[model samples]
Target chain A: MAVSSQVLSYYSFEQVDITRFRIRPEINRQKVEAEFSRAVYPYITWTDGTELYAGDYAVLIIRSDNPKLCRSGLKVTIGAGLLGAEFEKALSGKKVGDSFSVLWKGETVFVTVESVKNRHKPELSDDMIAALNIPDVKTVAAYQTHLEKKELDEFFFEHSRDAVGYVLKQVQANSSILVTEADWNQTVEWSVNRLAALAAMDGMELRTMTPEDFRGRIPVKSYDELVVLMQREAWESVRMSLLGEYLAKQNGDTINADGYETFLTEAAAPWGRTAEEYRKAYPEAYYLQNEYCDYFRRAVTAYVRKNYFKEEKNEH
Target chain B: MSIKFAEASTFDNLVREDDFVIVDFFSTSCGPCKILSTFLEDLEAELPFLSIVKVNTMEAPELAERFEIHAVPTLFFYQGGELKERHLGVLDEDELRERIERYLY
Candidate 1:
């Protein structure tokens, strides 16, 4: 028996526009694994002492079992300063086999389409059909009617709650999204102004009330009661931070190099500071950077276990 | 058992009567307040010793403000016209009953 050649074509960085390039029809596991094994230069720099060039690169790997309905899926790694907005601009309109480049850092690095691998739509085995409780699992329509209506209803209800819960969770998780001194001062000032307006509505002078005085006059039932409410809100904020960090890590798949950069920018945006600023302000950001990666891994694991892809049935 | 409800204006009269009063401060818009009102109604059905009263904050803002109530629903246990214990937010049905039993009798 002869072994089949499973290796896909590998492209050097000089051949394509890595920023805008895309692979058509998607690639399967064999191609992806091979791509991962291949090494590509990530950074290129000028010999001049004043200039530095950094190329953030990632291997696009589409697992054979990848469930994305799109033509292709990808995994990307990139430098921290690039915003997702840049990649959206670069690759949104481009087709597969197209390539282009833009200035990155101080040097221009060429990017190209290395390979395009076609994939066959996967088939569900008899075991899968039994697991799905369906006689036919070949087409989307086949499985549509067999779904449990009540389960779907419960799912939607749960989904809505989970959506809100996720928001609350994100707020609670990302509590470490540090508010700078200036940002905190700004928020305090805004809150004070709003409070002053409320006081003025009651024919009270804003000048007479300080922040401490304002809190006192708010007529809380008790100190304990106020603390409890504030604590709940704080927890929600922390949850949001954790969720954002989780999202950035789990969905490291991007179509282009710019997309990877954009992800980093968004992941760090909530802190009301740059990723660099966060690292400078708190030594924890350094550890958090890696911790964020771990969070994404956990999120992806949970997401897979939850089987978020299956459409739920409608309930009465 | 008689279930008595006192309007904010009549609260003074009820307190002056030297009756052990359970005053519920509630708002119509609050979900917990609605639940609590039903709970109080059930308590009134079971307990004859204590007078259950409700004050709607929306209708009686002055009374709510007087008590410094920022949130609803709040419960106040009064004995001989003096506040003994106060509960803010939703209270468990059993907890409310226990508090009323300890304070009123």
Candidate 2:
């Protein structure tokens, strides 16, 4: 099931001047400094013979009589509880090549210290940003520009909810794009499934949990009211996404089957699957719906980025 | 107990002493940080056993450096003096509640 909408009459401008909706957000200097500090310590390689400490990235070799525990290259951040509580507590103060057995999940597992990695922070420099190996972001100056662009995009997305609402209202006024009952039902189904998944995470049965019990999340008094509220919210969101899709297409960007297939080929390559394989694995409609929605989002973002600051004047 | 402010000097102590601590690095000028502060206040009132330590990035640059906090509104969840998880943004009430409950029990 795909959400379909058409732009009957285009906006007068080549691109919708997004400047009126844009806000110049303030940047926090300390946050930038901290980010620079993070970039300096992108990763910590194993330092041979170094002792493990709290906050150190530790790699271990498990050598157990049981095949289950014979795993090697188990990485854990000391005091990070990523592996578990006991795994970290046992690794503290341990040096490379040291052998010890720790009780993990009620099983005594033998472990050998493989390597310990500690971040040695460097000064914020082009070399530091380059060390991060982030694509196309090699210099400190480019990173700053990237951060600014990111903030602007964030501001637009966050603040444009109202603007999008206004656009939907205008579309309703000028156009008669039918948001079918099936579309509404699709949204309702999505909400129900999502809420059910969240309930399952808490070990609570969605069918058994009372509305009062779930009121912390959805404030409606009854399940019926909840459905109505969800339907309304979903309708708006679907329209917003479709609108973005419509705008993106009107601006010469391809948000069609061909573009998505090309994107899928690249994405599926990582998983050793071709686009056709992916299509075969899932229902055709499921792929269409997912790809359509993704394209819809990209359309909106592309439209915004291309036109958002197009008319801004130079600052001396 | 409640939301307490921390600097570099007190940051380690707060994380070490408190059984469950959420270190929130924020700035006064940020819009998201402002929104998160209110959520934190409400969260603190609801969950009284945990400590929410607010470290103003402007005041505690050294603390941000030590923790390697990359952004404002960054939350580092610590349990038993060990890092449990770290999140970088304004978490919804339900998500924030879920995280707190996971550690509380």
lDDT of 2 by residue, A1-316 (tens): 6754444554422233445654445555655654555465433333444887765666678866677666676555665454567777888889988999987656788989887776343457888777777789999998887666666666667766654544335544554445667766876677666566555545566667787677776777666776788788777655555555565666676544545565545433323334565443333333445554555555545555454443445521
Q: Considering every candidate listed, which one attains the maximal DockQ?
A: 2
Model 2 misplaced stretches (Cα beyond 4 Å): A1-20, A42-122, A155-160, A168-173, A237-294, A301-316, B1-105
lDDT (tens digit, per residue) of candidate 1 on B1-105? 134556777878775464467788876657788778766754543333346767777567677778877667888888878888788878877787567545542
Give all TM-scores, in the order shown.
0.31, 0.45
Candidate 2 lDDT by residue in tens digits, B1-105: 467899878888888776678888887756788878767765543333458889887677677767766566798899889999999889876677677656632
Cα lDDT tens digits for candidate 1, A1-316? 6432111222211221222211111124443332222211111111211111122222222222223311122312122222243542443333335555633333333333323222121343434334444455534334333333334444444444443334333433433343334433433444445445445544566666545654657644443444454444433333333444545544573222333333343333322223453333223432343344345435433443244333334311
Give candidate 1's error at residue B41 in angstroms. 1.8
DockQ of each candidate relative to the true complex:
0.01, 0.02
For every candidate, what share of the true interface contacts is present?
0.00, 0.00
